[model samples]
Target: MSKYFAVLLLLIFSTQIQALEKVTLQLKWTHQFQFAGYYMAKEKGFYQEEGLDVIIVPADPNNPNVDFRVLYGQAQFGVFHSGLLKQRLEGKPFVALAALLQSSPYCWMVKAQSGIYVPRDFQGKRISLLGHTENGELLMMLQRAGVNTDSMLLYSGKKPFDDFIAGKFDAMQVYSTNEPYQAQQLGVATREICPKQFGLNVYADVLFTTEAMLRDRPQQVMRFRRASLKGWRYAMLHLEESLAVTKANYATHKSLAQLAYEAEKLKDFIRVSGIPIGKMSAAKWLWIAQLYHLDVSQFHEHKADFIYSEVKQDPASLSWVLIIAAVLTLVCIPMYIQLIFSRKNKSHLR
Candidate 1:
């Protein structure tokens, strides 16, 4: 009886040990090099090795608010712009798990020969602006730089790349990665005016999760974070492999050379940030909150203590621990019941 009971316990424990955890990750944007780390992690089996089944969902531009909606409860984790996350943290119960890009990738681009020397040059000139939080940041930047944002004619539209190339606007707020690379590919002479150059340093991409998840499933969060950080480290070290993974995910840009360029550019941006990957500083958070005029007090109240500064354990080893613990728990349960029954019988005999 004891041998059968032990075998039964072992089988149950083994089944529990092999149980897979499912996690869905929401990307901030469509498939691009910006999210190459996650793709690399999936491709390299980092998540699987960590005992996680991760689904990476690319965000739809048409549904701009989809990330927040999914993150509120629908998804276990979400990739988002730190600025957007900062604003949402004011009222929403969300906490940033890690900072992906240490620096903002936003910049103003102009024709190389335009000789537009300074922000003052943008005054009274036509400028392309994307309507959203970026527009607000640009407005603030221009105000600080003594540029009359209202004096300039604003071309509010999507994919301002074509319009800028057609000489529709003197300059446009373009992603330092995509638009600039696309322009160079077309042989368009352009120069990037980094927002950081104009004192508009903001944190860009971040990994975030709801406060509820952080509290209820902290180990899961740690596992995901460790796996993601490992993926990023691998991507940075194995650049060519990461690019191949990116190409596989975004099939439209079928050119390997283009994919390589995109990957190299992302690597450069990451290097220039000076901060190591996955490190989010308190000062950066404070600056973002101040820039957005959000009430930081609200965030402090709910999530001040829950933010994970670093991974507490090796993600790769957590699964084994869970498996062992589950096995021990299963084995001990029946033994405890039997011991209780034997004790009761002895008492009755007495």
Candidate 2:
């Protein structure tokens, strides 16, 4: 009787272990309240309930990009922004399982005391951005307001708000949830201008995988999405607990108070559109496509047309700029040649 009972326990344990499906999810950035829902999901055993052994991977700047990790099978899924959707339209093999935020938290932040009240005020001003991520939205806002694109200057330096805080620039682009809150905490009065003001609001924070994954492992994809969305709903209702989980697992530079502030801001962004959390719409994708001036008709059949939008570069006058650059390079050739020769001669003499 004792031997039979021991065998039953071992069998039960092995069955439980075998039931859990192992998978990895790559976050778009470091661990913080930004990923509170995922943490809460794990903490609550939502993934386990779905028979998934979900591994949450934080993004490391020193490592390959999150998209590459997912593509190379290091991770089965990843969290990215609307930019991924745009890339998909432009020929990436990615497919989004969820739009984490109904509308983007992306917007332009400007010091209100600097006498710039609106998008029109951005003319001839230095606006710090996160690479070209939000440039399309900015240009669209400026164009709609008749602001001259040439007069505007964009600075894409890392941790961009440092200069802006010191009053070194006219305005800076930031997520509605993050930098604006930082500015407020530091007592810098600011205003935000979003794409929605000009009818160009796009979705943000997508959980995605490759098209091949959807083709080959559709059930797994569905299970992951359902589990993640469920986790988000639970996190939304239990903000403090979810945040505590985030703080415990992923050390953040932010104070609990600051994270709380972000939590509130995130809640607003997630539910602002009155859509269910993790929902996407065809109209929103269509709007972003129009912002980039892509062919909307071609959007009909591509998964992109149904799933996302085509984001392209701005149509500013590149020809004249290229011509001037070529002329300048031609004139600088002799100087460059002399400098190179001088450096080489100096090295040899030494």
Candidate 3:
């Protein structure tokens, strides 16, 4: 009977230990090559190795307020712009865990033969922009190039790339990773002008979580970060495997050439020194704060630390710090009880 009871207890404890830690990650956009690293991680069992079961939720265009949704605890983590994070962290508390892209991929592209060699050519031209943010960035870039945005006609909508190829717009703001590669695969030669060339360097695709999660479940966050960084490093190193994983996820957009081009571009973007993969710096945070016109003083007051520099450290340190502290307490607890009992006996004798 004693042997059976012991075996039953061990089984119960083993079952409890194998129960996976649940985490939810919200992507900034729909499934595409941009998020190939995360997909590769899931497909390759990296998250499982870290004892995590990660669920990736796609962002809804209709309900675009992922920041508030994440803040209210609808999700555990999210991928978004540092600008949006700066704005969201004003009153609400959130921490940036890692930056996927070292630099913004925002760029204006035109057909190579369109005679639109420079931004000045954009004056008196029609341009297609996806949203107001892209339009604003393009306008800023144009202004720097001495091209007045008022002089150009703006067409804003989500439409086919063929629209630009058919002379609908003289230029368009497309991701340096996506549309440009798609155009190249279609034999549509394009000239891309990165917005950063004009001194507009915004941080793109930042990973973040709520303050509550950080405080209450630091171990879970650490595990997730380590797994994600491993996934990112693998994706960066194994380009073909990463693209294969992405293609499996987004089978509708089939163009091996385009995927290859995007993978190469993204690799370059992620390799920049200032933008270490899965890390964030205080200087970058301050720069983002300034860009969004946020008060830096407020951040200094409630300052939440989210950057994980030790995310890639050895697995032993990944163990729960609180667990170690508890063990130390348990060891000292017996000595404390003995001291109390000894004092009580001496007082009774007196």
Candidate 4:
């Protein structure tokens, strides 16, 4: 009995090890508190609880494209921005899982001394911004404000914030949760022209995977999404521990104060009053797609598939269980009848 028990223990351990699914998550940028949920998921063993061995890959100079990595299968999952919607419209076969940030964090930052106060003020000024697809909210804000985006001088800079400070560019794009804090630390007084002011709301830090992954491994996707959301909830609720874990392990470059500032600012975007964390509303998505000028028919056709839903158990497996149960019942009925008749015969003999 002891030997058999030992064998059983070994088997259980081996089975658990085998059951762990090894997966990779490609991050949008370098390690920071922006990706706290993912870090917490891995750190707090939430991923492990879901039978996942997740490798959180941070963006570096070489590996910067999260979407390319995920779509090409280099990474099983990725965290990206609403820019992913345009790619999906272009037939990229991408699926958005959750929007960690319910509101857009992207904004154009200018020194307080700079006369640029609004999107309209950006006209005829040197601006550092990404492509229209990448920073559509900003562009849309400019357009809505009656600024001809094409007429404005735009360029991408390697050190945009520094350039803005040096008076090279009138304004540079920044994240409300991140760069504002950095500028504050550097003693630079800055003002942000956020898109939300113009009612152009976009989601950031979106978790997503490919359609192929969703279709082929729905259960894995469901488990990963569930665990990731759980991590997000925990991280939001336990900001101090999340900051400590991130500083000590993941983003050492950022000080605790800096992480805390980011955490505090992001709470407004992450935890809305009525909305659930990581919940993506279909109405908001349709509005975003409309902003991109995508085909309404196409958006409608792919809408259901693009948005994620819970994966149900396979019907084939359920049918197999029923078949086995029916067979067992059929086999037992005969034995039960024979036993009753045998007992009756024995009574007669008595």
Which of the two, 1 or 3, has more TM-score? 1
RMSD of each: 7.3, 24.6, 9.1, 6.7
Which ranges in model 3 have alpha carbons more than 4 Å from their true place? 1-17, 61-65, 118-121, 130-136, 157-160, 249-255, 296-350
Please, what are the lDDT tens digits per residue for candidate 3 over residues 1-350? 35544655565445435656788888887666777778777788888766678898877767655777678888898887755555545556777788888678888888898888766778888887556342345566677789877767877756747788777787888788878877876888899877677676667788878779877777777777778878888888888888887877663466766677777787776777655686667777776666555787865654445444434454434454444455546645765687799899999999
> Per-residue lDDT tens digits of candidate 4, residues 302-336?
88988887766644334434654565466557667
Give TM-scores for every candidate, taking all chains together and pairing residue i with residue i.
0.81, 0.79, 0.76, 0.84
CA lDDT of each prediction against the hidden true structure:
0.74, 0.74, 0.72, 0.84
Relative to the true structure, candidate 1 reaches a TM of 0.81
lDDT of 4 at 181: 85
Worst 10-residue lDDT window for candidate 4 reads 314-323
User: Which one wins on TM-score?
Assistant: 4
Return the TM-score for candidate 3, rounded to 2 decimals: 0.76
What digit string (tens of lDDT, one per residue) describes model 2 on residues 84-144?
7567667778887778876666788887877777778777788775454534676677778
